[model samples]
Target: MYQTTSKKTPWIFCKDIINHPQKAMAWVWGYISCKHSMMYTLFVYTLLLILVLLYYVNHRESEPNHDETFKAKVQQSFIKFVEENMPKRDQNKETRAVYSMRTMSSNGSLLEDEHAKILKQRAGDIQREYIGFKNKKPFNFHCDKCAVVASSGQLLHSNSGQEIDNATCVIRMNNAPTIHYEKDVGARTDIRLVCFRSIDFMNKDTLMIGKARFDKMVIWGMENPKHKKIKETFTSKFIRKYPGVDYYSLSNSGEKKATRLYEEYLGMDRLKSNSWLSTGWFTMLFAVNMCDSITVYGLPDGNQCSAGSKKSILYHYYEKRYDECWMYNQHETRMKTGHRYLTEKAVFKQWAQMFNISFKAPAWNLTNVNASEPIKSPFISKMEKIGKKRTKR
Candidate 1:
């Protein structure tokens, strides 16, 4: 009966509260007010949690945040390797000779001669126009001392990175990688000179690596059928996706001038020869015009072309097995289509004497062109091998 009476008492109280709604509300409100501080804190915490969740979702949708950790790690690993394997060279640093542009003089024999004047007049407009991408204004830049790094196999195991990085500006050629080989080739890439044919390869490297390794890219070559195909496919897509990369191209007039310069240097007609001027040719010209003091690395000097003296090295620093001398010989001997590599080396020797240019990594003796021997023909080499076998017998 006591348990029954207790249950009935609670029910009677609930019935009174249900009948008098104002009293029930007053009781509930009094209880809430007494715990107001705790309730407010819980509400504020919930609101903050919702805001934090929204921020996290927004951040995740954007570019994957390595927060530059990936780039840093890559650099760090390469740096460690360099320190362990090839210590930096701080002694006997190479010095640059003072050079200044000669002004117009009455002698007319120097650079400001009538012919030079005409060429400058033609190039004046194009030189000033930087040609930025994505409707951005082009920035002006200059390098007092520039290092033009080549992709020759001579660079392998050279440990020339420290010296190359000391330059004011470093220019790299098409599709040459400095990531893994940063110890041999400097980690700095101020400008990349790419030909039309190599643009697709460069883009592929960029896409696969998920990073643009160069600051500025200057493309040269005629807008041929192949280039048109690349433009419609890779180039357009690259420009749209990577607006941060500064893209520039040499004008038709500029290319013509460069070709003319090559002709003048080689003392031959390019069309008649049916030969391609090596990229090194254009790269040297660019260095002459853009940089005050130029130092070239990894290009075989004229003396190295001789049969006896030629060091057996790979055609490219990255390529392991291809013989550099053999390839040069094959290309130089091609009757219809080939680069006159030996001839070009002779021309470069002449230019080195004239300009404030110097070569290293099998350095050049600019005084003499006597040692610039032609690469021996592959057939002749084969016949010589056969003769040697007979002699052994």
Candidate 2:
């Protein structure tokens, strides 16, 4: 039905010979090239838009983010707050806290000379094994903001990576890894407090996750320093396991301090759970001395643990629900086993109110317009009110 000139149309000239192969081939090739050109155009425009968006996000010309601004303002407040509680006259900032003695006021002064001596010797030996051991020196750093990252599962999908990374210093608890979980909890580690229980649980290869990854480590020891030689030997083994990292002996001094403090303040009335403060408690103690405005992420404030949700609740990011959450709750329900967690929660709430310290978890609080502070657990207040009523009666 169609006619073509053989001289002008290349396909027409070859129609009899090749059955219009040239024209058919030309049309197919032309269509493909046109489509490819359209795709290329679209790709170029998309790339340009992406570049503009990146420049806008990465550019620092705009005002600082709200969190950044708030943290900056809190810096002056932090220095002043710490100064009031821990005096420079009594506590030197440069004092090598490894040997720093606590004022036995909170806990009765009770360490015997032999126990104190064993603790000192243990600390010296452990320091000698670390990468860099300084004698009688205070921590050689300061930060405007510090983040104490707790391993509570509430951090699961928090999307707090950017905020956590922004801290001047970040202290992580236990053997919690940030590898796959960096989105919820950022991958910054200024210091990590290693629990004695996790010593065997940690791998030598995992410990080799690069020195550049962190600044230093503080190894928490046994709850009670009463074992003398066993404490020293156990602590020495713990340090020897991680030969390459630079770490401090939070072992004896802290153990001795906790013995007095918890006994006098938290223990005497006496559930066995009353004995040792969790490593998180010790970490907070460290932060109080070093940081200004401490914001703890996931320390289990005892607010959201409902009976219906208890089964699904995870106590730690490192443990499975069946493995840890239930066991932890089960232990709490029994006497003398759990670490006075409810009391600890009460103390933390008081501390948060007294100190400028705040909590961040179940992330919506930050993004929501109405919520400024962490929601207080109604149960905690009710318990306090009942205690007050009993006291009045």
Candidate 3:
């Protein structure tokens, strides 16, 4: 027996909601008015959804930074701020930046300890010896006067060999030969400064090395992985072959300081200028430090560029190739990857005025240069200050 009740069934309500929206809405409103429980359940669910959305927003806002790019930018900004605001106390870690000439009224010689700092000697390391090989002791030799002979073509037929040989010490650069050119370049070779690349020339036997050729050899190169590996490989082979010849290497730090000198005093950025420093540059520095008086031969001075007489001379005395002035002009004016030969010579000119340095075999006329003028480098000027203070004491 079928019985009819006044309450709407679930099936009828669902059908009405699907087929008739107006009737469904009216029935829903009527049900809500009649039943408070259904209204409360809907309100509770809506409130819970709103709360869940709020919680999600808050959780996202509280999360820590995990972005690598954002972190890198923050780190860079902090480093920049520190560098800009802080005063540097350690010269060893000073910025590798090009500084223009700054005048200071002080004069001083580089102290031995300061020299060691520049060299950046390591613990248990010999100051001067064949590096990477056991030595009896550090190299302990000095000369009151030194003659730094150049490989320039200016020495050709100059007949200055005897005068060069007369010096207390003689320094040669790279793999320059004295076998046949001894009459013009001198026969004595006390020290030979070789860049690592010159090792290839030596291996080719184009440049000679032995106890009979030179008393000691100093190999130096810029600080780089390739240069380092080449230096190590060359050192091993050289020591194995010439066991008796004295050998030493200029430290990476020492090379760095030399590059800095070019930047600070000469206003030439080695990196930016793409300038490969000539062996003459290192030879001059060694002479300044090790010799009381230095006489450089066969090298041009600052005035060579402007002087009309130098155009006919060849680039190398051994070879009759490129013209001296033409080579200098090309290298000096090159947009990239060339030695700053003229610029280096000009700085050498300034050094002549400052130190006990003299030029010969195409002598420099530095009579116009003022000796009392301030040195071009702040580091050098600080050294001068120290010298002044020592004099006062």
Candidate 4:
């Protein structure tokens, strides 16, 4: 019999001792595991905090507050301030007056009743050439003294100013608002005929810009705006109210005849004649119809203006370069073809010599005001001598 004492008995089985540990030992292992996990979490949090701090410092350095640098201060105070205070120069006045004078002068006499009635009756005649009226009344027109002025690029800086001004009627196209040394452009023109094809040719304020009382003629080449169906079209809505304004159409026969003459006789490879043909041809036609003799000026001379580094001179319509200038090629081509047509003008001039039709060129020079004998044509020797005497005075 085993006597049981008050002390607790221990079961020391090897398997039980190996498999199970005391409560204190298990608690110690759990505490060590939790401490390791906490250390890892703290390490990750510290790294993230460091990255955020670095980003904040870099961002703060990149952007600065106002009043920081010399570059900004100079841009704000000096450069921009100076630009705001600069003044623009005004346009020259003589140029303005010349154009004003051109538009102001107007003198055109309509065909008298007898002449008009005759022309109307013969409108369908289909004759070889136009025949003059049978009992032709004496026309007040002094066509023998007629002059035509044209602006060419070749005339720029050419100092040919006085010669240009001496003409009876200086005809120019699309006269721009004048500026320094260009006052003669406006002042010398006695008549202004506004030629139009598209509405884009002139602005609504063109009449106001010239500020002169001039006769305005609207030419509707092949493109007639009034016939088109579109509303607000350029031709239909244009308001041309000054006196002496008239609208006329070229007969299909006239156009065909002119085109055939140009291509067959003049050797123009291109089938079409541009604005120059339309206007130049029309001008010639009108002159033939109304005037006994007509003189031409400012037509193309085929000499181009030289480019300068310091100054830019505006050229006459046909004289400007083909690429850079607007509405120029058509005029140039027309001029070349029309020049061929006017070859007969030399013959006409010879005929005028016998009949006493005076043809004169101007004698003024922009470069040399004191220079003598600016007239270049041999046919007008007497006129040149007179011009020289006038210049001397």
Best by lDDT: 3
Task: Candidate 1: give the clashing pairs.
Answer: none
Name the regions of candidate 1 deviating beyond 4 angstroms.
1-130, 135-140, 205-212, 222-226, 369-393
lDDT of 4 by residue, 55-173 (tens): 69998888785555643453334333223221110134332222221111111112224323433233222122322122222212223344444454434454444654565544444
lDDT per model, in order?
Answer: 0.60, 0.54, 0.63, 0.35
lDDT of 4 at 239: 35
Model 2 lowest lDDT segment of ten: 364-373
Give the per-residue Cα lDDT of candidate 4 at 260: 44
Candidate 4 Cα errors over 4 Å, as ranges: 1-144, 157-170, 174-183, 186-195, 204-210, 218-235, 240-253, 267-278, 303-393
lDDT of 2 by residue, 1-393 (tens): 899743323334234324543354464454445555676445445544665686688775675787767644543343343343333323543432222332231223323343334333433343332222334343434467998888877788778877998999998977788777888888888887766666555444554366326767666564335545544654477456556556565546545554444433331222222234677766765665566688888766553453445446567786775434454444434323355555455545544544557888852122221111222333224323434444455
Per-residue lDDT, model 1, residue 228, is 68
Candidate 3: C-alpha lDDT: 0.63
| Residue pairs in collision within model 3 | 106-384, 107-384, 107-385, 108-384, 108-387
| Candidate 2 Cα errors over 4 Å, as ranges | 1-141, 222-244, 251-253, 267-274, 306-311, 321-328, 363-393
Instruction: Name the top TM-score candidate.
Output: 3
Q: How many residue pairs clash in each candidate?
A: 0, 3, 5, 13
lDDT of 1 by residue, 47-117 (tens): 44665687689888885758566644543443343243222221212110000111111122334244334
